[model samples]
Target: MPVDEAGAKAKGGRKRLIAIAVVAVGMLAGAGGVYWYTQRGSADHAGEKQAEAAAAEGEAEGGEGHGAADADPTASYIEVAPMMVNLRGGGAQAKFVKVRFIVVAAEGKTDAVKGRIPVILDALQPFLRELRPEDLNGSAAVFRIKEEMIRRSTAALGKGMVRDILIQDLIQQ
Candidate 1:
């Protein structure tokens, strides 16, 4: 009878320990879930609030009265004339490249860009003339060329006058 009682006490102690461990695991899991929810949920809520505010403001300002162009006043595009330049291939290999691109300018600034096209071309000609056939071999070269043109165009036309250079056609021979 005494041995039976001791066995019961040991069994009860094991059950209590198991229960405590389960409770501890549950609490840790709950805490982790709450932390994850708070971190991820806040960004989504912020975006939703911004969108709602914009919609409310637009409604208040008579959204239908404003045209699409007026709603977001960004630059428009104007195509520049195609340019053909002789690339300096090593020795007498004689290579030529043709490129055509559009210039992004603020609304009503197309005419100014059009009038200054010659200056833009003059600024770009030197860079194009210096390119070797191998220099424009891959996509990386094309990206570098676009960046250079953007830098040159912005420099020639003053900051903000030219927004970007969009390549329309590029041919190498």
Candidate 2:
């Protein structure tokens, strides 16, 4: 009877070992599938980028492209002097952010926008001073800041004067 019991125990152990091996194989297969899926996605993304680059190159060579006809060849930019403003909510140690930007003007509106630089700065100064350190956290923050600046510039210079604001430098200290 003892011999029979020992044989049964050996069979049970063997079954457990088999189950563990099957589970390990399944986990490895799942990992491999995930890796393959991620690699395939990146490859697809790379292909898309390459196609875009080719399209851009074709446009550069005078191919009929989307929005190329409407693009202005004489677009002008007005550079803003760097300004540093203290950030809000900086407890004891004063925090400041410095930014230099360029204002994109509408077609034939470069001088108009340049003339309103002081007004634009006046509109932007208070807005910049009110910004907290936390407000400049990520890329989204930068986009928000740009949009706000555009809005302010538009309000200051009237409609169709400011097209965009290109942030040349942003430093926080």
- The top-ranked prediction according to TM-score is 2
Q: Which stretches of model 1 miss by more than 4 angstroms?
A: 1-73
**Candidate 2's TM-score:** 0.59
Candidate 2 lDDT, 18-96, residue by residue in tens:
9999999999999999999878856764554445444434433335432232255766778899989999984876878
List candidate 2 segments past 4 Å from native: 1-71
* Candidate 1, 1-173: lDDT as tens digits: 99999999999999999999999999999999989977785665455445544543443243545223334456577778899999986655466888877776766787888889898999999999999866765445555676799899888988867766666556665
Q: List the residue pairs that clash in candidate 2.
A: none
Q: Count clashing residue pairs per candidate.
A: 0, 0
Question: What's the lDDT for residue 61 in model 2?
Answer: 39
